[model samples]
Target: MPILRNTKKEAVIKDITVIGGGVVGASTALHLASLGYQITIVDQNNSNIAKNSEHRTGSTASLGVLMGNIFTRHKGRSWELRKRSMEIWPELIKSLSTEELPIIVNTPLVKIASSKEEMIKMENLIKQKKYLGIDFLPDNYQSLPIWIKNKYGGLISYNDGQINSLKLIDSLFLKLKSLNVNIITSKVKYIKRINDNTRIWSVILEDGKAINSHIVIICAAAESERLLQQLNYKLPLTKILGQAIKLKFKNSQVNFSGWPAIVNIKGINLIPEQPDSLLIGATLENELSPDKKYLHQMLETIREKAEWMQNYLIKEKWYGHRAKPINEPAPILKSIEKGLIINTAHYRNGVLLSPACAEWVSLEINKFHQ
Candidate 1:
C-alpha cells in the first residue's frame, strides 16, 4: 500500500479517489465514506457549463424519474440493479430528510400502455411481479387520473418514485462535507497505476496535481472512455442526446396534488411538478443539436391524450447528453483491474440507479479486500 506523510511527517495510508462529481460519483463517495474509508472526489466543477442546458450533464438535465418498479424486465442485471436501487432510495431519502434536505418527490409512477401489446406485457409483468411481492395496481381506465386519456389503461408502481436530480446532488455534497470527505474541483487528466506490486494508482489532474490512492473509481460518464483509453483500455461509450421541456398550466385551477408521474409505452415521461407545472421529456436523438420537432411531437402526443395540457404554455426546453455503452448493456459496473473500477455509462437511468451502483462499488471493494 502507498503511504503518505502528513504535515507532522507521520505515515498515513492512502485511500480511495473517485473521479466525477455527478450523482453517481457523489453517491459512491458517500457510500464509501460511510464505510470508514478515506474518500476524495475530483470534479471539474464547471459552473458555466452546468448552467448551459445543452451542455448539462445527464443528471442535471434529467426529469428525475424513478422507474425502477415500472420497468418490464423482471430479471437480469438491469432489473437487479433497479430492484436494489428502489430498496435503497427510501432509506437514503429518510436519512437525508433528517438534515431537512427534501430531495425526493414522494409519488407513485404510472405507466400507461399505448397499445394492446404493451397492455399484455404489463399483465404478464403484474403476474411475475406478484411472485416477487412487488405490488402493482390493477390496470383500469377508471382507476387512472381524470386527465389521462388512455384506452388500454395503465399500471401503477407504488414503490417507484421521483427525485429532484439537482437537489439530490446538492444534498449529497452536503452529506459528504459532514462526513469530512475531501472534494477537489478540477478535471482529471489521466489515471495511472503508480506501483503494480502495491496496486496503488495515481489520478493526474489537468493542473498537474497527482492524487495517490489505493483505489480509483471512474464515474465520469462519457469522460470515462477517454480516461480509460489513455490506460490502453477501450471503454466504448457513446453520448446519447436527451431533451426535456417544462410547461406551465395556464389554468390556475388545475390541481396536480397526488398526481403520479406518467410514462407512456414509448418511454417518454410526463412528470407533474409543484404548483401548476409539468415536466415532459425526453427524446433520445443521435444528432448534435436539440431538435425542436421532437419536443413538439412529444408535447402533441401528451396533449392528445391529456386534453388539459392543450392550454399549457411552454416554459423552457433543455438538452443534455447521456453516456451509453456500445454493444453492451447499460451501467458498465465492474472493476477493470485490481484497483480501478468503472461505474459509469448508466445512460438514461443514472439518477434511478445511482444508489445501487454506489453500493455495488462498495461491495466490490470489500470483496476484493476479503
Candidate 2:
C-alpha cells in the first residue's frame, strides 16, 4: 500500500484515489470510505472531456426511475443490474442519516399501451420476466389515476419509483464532505506508473502535481477509454447523446407529484417532479447533431398519448451523453492491473445502477486487501 504522507514526513494514512466524481465515482468513493479506506476523488467537473464527468451528467438529468419491471425489453444484464440496484436502494437511502436524503418517490409506474398490438407485446414481455408486484390493469383502466388518457389499458408496476436527481446529487456531495473525503476539483492530465515491478500508480493532475495511491479506480465515463489507452488498455466504448425537457402545467389543479409516472409504449416518459411540474424526455442520438426530424417525432409521440401536455410549456431543455460498451449491456467492473480498476459504461442506467455498481467495485477493492 502507498502511504499518504504529510509535509512533516509522517505517513498519515494509505490512500485510495478514485477518478470521476459523477454518481458512479461518488458512490464508489463513498462505499470505499465507509469501509475505512482513506480516499481522494479527482474530477475535472468538465463535461466536455471527462469520462466520469459530472456537470449535468446522466445522473443529474435522469428522471430517477428505478425501472426494473417497466419499459425494459428483456431480463438481460440490464434487467439484472436494475434488479440488484432496486434491492439495495432502500437500505442505501436510509443509511444517509447525516443529512436529509433525496426525495425517492415510491410510486407505481403506469405503462400504457396505445394499441392492442402493443398491449400484446407488453403482455408477452410480462410473462417472460414473471415479475411480481406488477399487474395489468383492467381493460377499462380502472386502477390507473383519472389523469391518464388514451383508450388502452396500462400495467402498474409496484415499488418502481422516481427521485429528485438534483437533490440526490446534493445529498451525496454533502455526505462525502462529512466523511472527510478529499475532493479535488481539477482535471487529471494522465496517470503515471510509479514502477514497473510494483503495483503502484500516481495521478498526474493538470497543475503538474502527482497524487500517489495504492489503488486508482477510473470511473470516468466516455473519458475512461482515452485514459486507459494511454496506459495501453483498449476499452471499446461509445457515447450516445440524449435530450429531455421539463414542463410545468399552467393549471393549478394538475398535480403529478404523487401519481405514477406514465411510460408511453413509444419510449416517452412523463415523470412527476414537483407540484404541477413534470419531466418529459429524452431523445438518444449517437451523432453530434441530433436529427431534428427524429426529435420532432418524439415530441409528436408524447403529444399523441397525453393531450393534457398541451396546457403546459417547456420549463427547461437539456442534452447530454451516455456511455456504452461496444457490445456489452452490463457495466464494465474489473481490475485492469494489480492496483487499477475501471467502472464505467453504464449507458442509460447510471442512476439506476449506481448502488449496485458502487458495491461491486468496493467489493473488488476489499478483495485486493484480503
Candidate 3:
C-alpha cells in the first residue's frame, strides 16, 4: 500500500515505524494508526508468521483471567491499570473484531488449599474484591455440573475468556490493513534523523532498505535490546525462559471453565480451553536442560493439581523467552529522545496488558508533537 497522506495538520505525523510485530509491537501499530500517523510495522514474520509469539504459545483468554495474579503483585497504579485492562478487554475485542473471538468454554480449575487458614484467606479475598469492585472471585461452586469440585471451596474466577494468540495477531493485522497501515517483513537496525528542517526520520532495515518516518517505536521482545544496542540505547532488560504444554481432555472438558485460568499460584498456572485442551505453564527457569524428563515434570506439575487433567491427551507443546522489563511499565513507553520510542518488557502478562500498554505508548508517541 502507498503511504497515506492527509491535508489536515492533525493527520500529519512524519511516519512512525514499529519494530517487532508481536503483541506489544502489533498493538502499538494499531493504536498509532488510529492516531492518524503514517505507520509501518516491521517484522521478520511479515509474510509468514506475522505477529507470532516468542513462545508462540500465549494465552488468548481475557485479561480477567490474570487479574488475580496481578493483584497479588501490585496494589497501586499497576494494579489499577491491570484491572482497567480487564475492563477494557471485552470492549476492545468488540471494536477490533480483528481475530476469531475466544470461545466461552467452561474451565476445570484444580486448586489445592494447603490449610484452613489458606482457605480462609481465599474466601475473604473473594468477598472483599467481589464486594468492593471488579474481582476475580467466582460466586458459585455448588451449581457446577462437573464432578470436579473443591471440598474446601477453591475460589473460582468466573466469566474468563480465551483466544488463540496467532489468530488474534492476524486479526489485528487485518484491522491495520483496513486503516492503511503498512507492515514489512524485515528487521530494523536503527533510527536516524535526516533533513533537519523537516525533522523527518528514517528507519534503516537490516536488509538495507530505508523506511522514512517521523517517529520510531520499538516493540520487539527479547530482541528489542539487540536492535536498540545498534543505536547505543540500552535499558535494563532480561530474558526469562518459559515452557508449557497443551492437552485435550475430550469428554471431560469443563464447559463452565472459562479456560479455568489459574491465578496467584506459587509456581505455575494451568489455563484451560475449549473441548479438551488445557494450557499448562511452568517455572521461569533458565539454563535448564530441555530433556524430555524435565518437560514431563512441568506437565506433571500442572496435571498433579487437577485430577481432571489426567484424562486429557497431549496436543501441542511450547517454549519461549518473555522480556522482563526493569523498573516498571513506564520504561518501555518513555521517550528517550526525539523521534525514538519503545514498548517492551511485558513479561508474563503480555497478552493481558497489551492493549492498555499499547494505548499508553501510542499516546506517548503522540505527545512528542505537544
Candidate 4:
C-alpha cells in the first residue's frame, strides 16, 4: 500500500485508484480503506449531481418511480448477499457521523394496490414457492399501508430497507475522505496494459497521469461497459434513463409522510425526506435524457396520485442513468484480466447494493495479496 499522511493537507498517492466519485466509487473506496488499502477516487460531479440531474440532463421525472425488483427475485447466494447488504445500514450510520442519515427506519415495504385484482396478484406472489423464496414482496406495491405499523414498517423481511440515496452517497464520500482516499478530478484518458490485456493493467487520467496498481476494479456505472470492452471483455450491459422529482405536499393521509419510502404505483417510487415533501422518481428507457414529452407524462402521473398535489409545487427535480446487466440479475464480478476486475451493471440497486458490491470487490483485492 502507498502512504497516506495523518496531517490535514498532503499530496500522498495510494495503491488503489477508483475512477468515479458517485455512490459506487465512494462506497468502493470506503470499504477498501477500512481494509487498509491506499485508495483514490475520480469524478466530474460531486454530491450535488443527486440534487438535480433532471433539468441539467434534459430529463423530467414523475412522483412514483422504481429500480425494478432485485429484492423479490433473489435466489440462494444472490438472495443472501442482498439480505446481508441491507443489514449493513446500522454500521453505515455510525461510519457516517456527519449528515443526518436519511430515515431508513423500517417502514412497510408494501404492494399497495388500487383494486382487487392487483391485490390478488400480490397474494399469489408471496405464496409462490422457490428455494430462494425470491417472490416475497407483493406483486404490486399498492398493498402497502399509508404509514408505518406497530412502530415500524411491519414484519417486512429479514433484509429489505430504504435509504436516502443522495445523502448516503454524500456521507460515504466524507467517510472515505476521513480515511485519506485521494480523489482525482480528471477523467480517465486511457488504460495502460501492464502485461497483456488479459493479465495486468493500469489507467491513464485525461491529464496523462498514470495510476498503476496490482488490482483495479471498474465501478463506473454505465461506463463499465466501455471499460470492459477496452479490456477485451464482453459484458452485456445497457443504460436506462430515469427521472425523479421532489414535491411539496398538503393535507396528506400518509403518516410519517415526511420520512416514509415506498415503491409506489405507475412505476413511481418515493421517499419523503421531509414533512409534506417527498422525492419521487424513475422512468426507464434506453435514451440518455428525458424529452419534454416524458417530463409532461411524469407530472401527470404525480397529479393523478393525489388531488391535493395540484396545489403542491415541485421543490426539486433530478435525472440520471442506471446500468443493468440482463444476462444475470446479480452483478458481474468476474475478472476480465488477471490484475483487473469489473464491478458494474448494478442497475437501480446501486445504492442498495453498494455495501455488498464493495465487500465482494474488497475480498477479491485481498485475495490478490494472498
On TM-score, the candidate that comes out on top is: 1
Candidate 1 local distance difference test against the native: 0.79
Tell how far residue 161 is off in model 1, in angstroms: 0.8
- lDDT per residue for candidate 4 within 166-267, as digits (tens), equals 556666777777788877777776666787643445788777778887667787766767767776666777767776667776656543343334645554
The C-alpha TM-scores of every prediction are 0.90, 0.85, 0.78, 0.76
What's the lDDT for candidate 3?
0.60
Candidate 1 vs candidate 4, lDDT winner: 1
Query: What ranking of all candidate models by TM-score puts the best one first?
Result: 1, 2, 3, 4
lDDT (Cα, tens digit) per residue for candidate 2, span 1-370: 1111112122233578999988889888877776677899988873223222322576666667777666445566666667777777777776653434545555677788788887887677667654556777545444434355646666777767776666666666777788899989898889879997665789999899999988898988988988998998898999887777778889766666446655544667777767688777778888754566666777778776665656777777766778889977648988878789888988887888888787777666556633
Question: RMSD (Cα, Å) of candidate 2?
Answer: 5.9
Lowest summed lDDT over 10 consecutive residues: which window, candidate 3?
57-66
**Candidate 3: misplaced stretches above 4 Å?**
1-14, 47-70, 73-75, 98-124, 131-152, 195-199, 250-267, 288-294, 326-331
**Greater-TM-score candidate between 3 and 4:** 3
Segments of candidate 2 deviating more than 4 angstroms: 1-14, 46-55, 71-76, 97-102, 124-131, 138-150, 251-258, 262-264, 289-294, 368-370
How accurate locally, in lDDT, is each candidate?
A: 0.79, 0.72, 0.60, 0.58
| 10 residues in a row with least lDDT, candidate 1 | 1-10
lDDT per residue (tens digit) for residues 1-370 in model 3? 2111212245456477888887678777876676667788988765334123334422222122334222443376676556656665666666666235443322333344445676777666656554434243354544555433334545555433345565567667777888898878877777777877776778888888999877778777767778777768777677666666667776644543533444334345656555445566654655423345656776665455445556557776656666777756532556777777777777777776777777777556555643
**Candidate 1 backbone collisions, by pair:** none
Poorest stretch of ten by lDDT in candidate 4: 148-157
